[model samples]
Target: MIDHRRPVGPRTLAARAKAAVTLSASLRAAVSAGEVRRVVCLAPDPHARFAAVELGADFFVDTVLANGYGLCSYVFGWNPARQTVNAPAVDQFLGGYGDLVLRPDLATLAPLEPGVWQVVCDVEWPDGRPVPEAPRTALRERLADAEQLGLVPSVGIEQEATFTGADGAPLVPAGLDYSVAGLTPLRALLGDVHAAVDGLGLGAESARGEVHPGQYEIVLRHRDAVAACDDAMLLQAAVRRAAAARGVRAGYLAAEASGMGSSCHVHLSLSDPEGVPLTAGATPGEPSALFGHFIAGILRAAPDLTGIWAPTWNSYVRLRTAPFSPRSLRWGRDDRTAAVRLAGSGRSLRLEARFAGADAHPHLVVAALVGAGIAGVRERLPLPDEARVVGELARTPWEALTLLDSKPARAVLGDPVIDHQLAMLGEELTAGLDTVTAWQRARGDLRA
Candidate 1:
């Protein structure tokens, strides 16, 4: 496998400058042609979304400067809430007073409105080094590790979300599921969403009505790990923008009191440098050693990785045994109830991870998967018996936090990443603990 002679590392800053020059020319031409007026620069944060807008002319100049050098410190200062700056994060950002260079090839620049275009950028330190806490950087590091083992990963993501009307209620009443009548009401909206996603060069494989009322699932084709995660993020943005244009809202919360849960399922496969699938064995329906090792790694790390995959407080509510969400750490052939489902055979074999919620960060999720799988390979871990079914995964946020704080998680995901995530999520958990909910009020007010 691994071609030891091949080079590692991303495009240099010089190369990015050249690409930015070419892009600037195109942007100027589009502006002069009256095809664009405004440019939106976007960077996805842990929980909140960050964006900066500028006139087309101003954006062209800034783009060139950013690519040639870097963008300012405000980009990485804020926490997930966008309210306060995490002091440690600020220290990492050159003491909250420096710039961050954009990664050379990790950006999606496309038209979002008639006279405006949006650019999704992945970033690094000004010196062209990976930012330890950055999700994209985490995934990139894991991918590099896979490359060392001669393994290339392809990831396919399936995202399910619900639509709500202007009143913040389900767009349609309950009980439609996958019926034609259920889908007919939202056909126009779905068409626009698909069109917008396709226009941005994000491959949207298919979209369909889901089992829940006002819920829908969109499947994206497989791509190299980083690209797939990027596409997934963009897809979510596209859906929300498209829905807003139609006077509705698109929500990806894991669980809603009256509606079913939404999820983000990841399908992964390993291939060689030449693109030959490595998951299948000589015998039909059997798995190769590489596949077994990868699966073993995922199973071993599933508990520790749960917090990242199901980050929100509502995420645990979606992990019950009913309605197809997995409750156990088990693998099964064509079994939707299992955490890991084996689909296809031979060249088409892949593992589908059913644990992630739609609310999880795409980059973090991919990083965890790739990191764990690589760990499995490096350790030469053995696969568990196919017939064995493990008990339920962490069913609550506290359980997930305990697992995440363990040594195994730190070993799998470097200490920097684990520490940063724990700090961020720990804040959310603390805030939640201080609040009293309506459910508590209803159940304990008079009795207590």
Candidate 2:
């Protein structure tokens, strides 16, 4: 529920009329039908404010910084400002201020892919430049690659997270109860989430108690790749809001315990340009070499991109002994232990990446995966005869961060976003170090 007290309306009716004329009939109907609205717009970042104004959105909420990480692109109210001028079949994008997208205009909406805002940076991009390295850009590039190969990625994300006790109790208690019956509190909290998903038309399949106490998982049906990613982010926001209403903390990291780990398993399939199932093995020779390259590319890039998949200090906790936490970069036929696992053979064949953690930004993760895969396919990269599954995991968060901080990986991800991510990680580590430890007090080791 956004507060629409103030909106970013154009200065004059003529201006509004001019903008409306650019929209296609379907888009026009959507706006007239109340599908799109002039809502409150806020801009904390001056640069973003300038861009929003140029984009012609009528609301701006000021934030403390120039950019709200990804928020600038998340609140523009569905559809690329440019695309609305012509396309009728595509709806307006919709989502929170953080995960907005261009949505389709339809009377009936699906639970998983609801009509929402398509949040995009107002910054212009050249036709030839690689989609700006942001999550959306990356996904677009990857999606394009899939198209070139006559494949479309239809995906669903199964997400697991936790809601804590009202008193700020640790996210996971000592007990190890995983049964649905034992998770009464979780159910009570998620009831609103169920309603919200339904109301928003997000085709959410089910939300259930996980194998861990206090942990829960929501499964959503497969949809377009971008929609699937948007749904994942929206689902998290829904859960967070619902939990807050219930006075519970929603923790997305892995288990607080030293041993147990959490998972963000992505299930994906590919289709042909005409929307026919390409996974049916009816395609041409060499069994879609592009698919093989995509898998290989993801495996190749896994080492550098791991940070994006598991992007928090706490996420490293799930690196080992956790179900679906791959010990190595091997691809297998339905094998959970491999980093990249193949499910269903030929055409109906798809890849599932279990390496991602719940803490990751869904768009970023999928885009990065797609980029790596596209890079592999475009280059015709060779794959090993077998999936290179291994048994070791990053020793600690520090170790993983160190690996990510190295020159090789840094070169691959380039500047700005990579640097930004590293800075965030450093901030987290500093905060962790600054905290006083009970052990220090117990040992009388507090020194001035």
lDDT of 2 by residue, 1-448 (tens): 2211111110122222243233323333443555543321222111011122212121211221123222333322222122121112111222222332222111111222233432323221222233233454445555666566665677778778766776646455643334655665455566776776555456667766676657777777776665576556656666776777767777777554556566778876655655565433344322256577777777777776666776666677677656557657777767776777777665456778888877666766776676667677777887655655532335566665666666644444545445544544555566568778766687786563
Q: 1-448 in candidate 1: lDDT tens per residue? A: 1110101112223333355556656766676776777766665666624445344545554564346335665555555555545446345654646777654342345566677776656667766776767776777777777888888888888888889887777777674555787777788998888888776665567777877778888877777676677668777888898999999899988876433678888888888766778899887577788888998898889888888888878788787533678767888888887889988887778899888888888888888988898889888899888857754568888888888888888877788888777766666687678789988898897796
Candidate 2 structure lDDT: 0.53
lDDT of each: 0.73, 0.53
Please tell me which predicted candidate would have the highest TM-score against the true structure: 1
**Per-prediction TM-score:** 0.86, 0.68
**Which residue pairs clash in candidate 1?**
2-150
Where is the poorest 10-residue window by lDDT in model 2? 2-11
Could you tell me the lDDT of residue 123 within candidate 1?
A: 69
Error of 1 at 165 (Å): 2.4
Flag regions of model 1 displaced more than 4 Å. 1-39, 48-80, 85-99, 104-107, 444-448
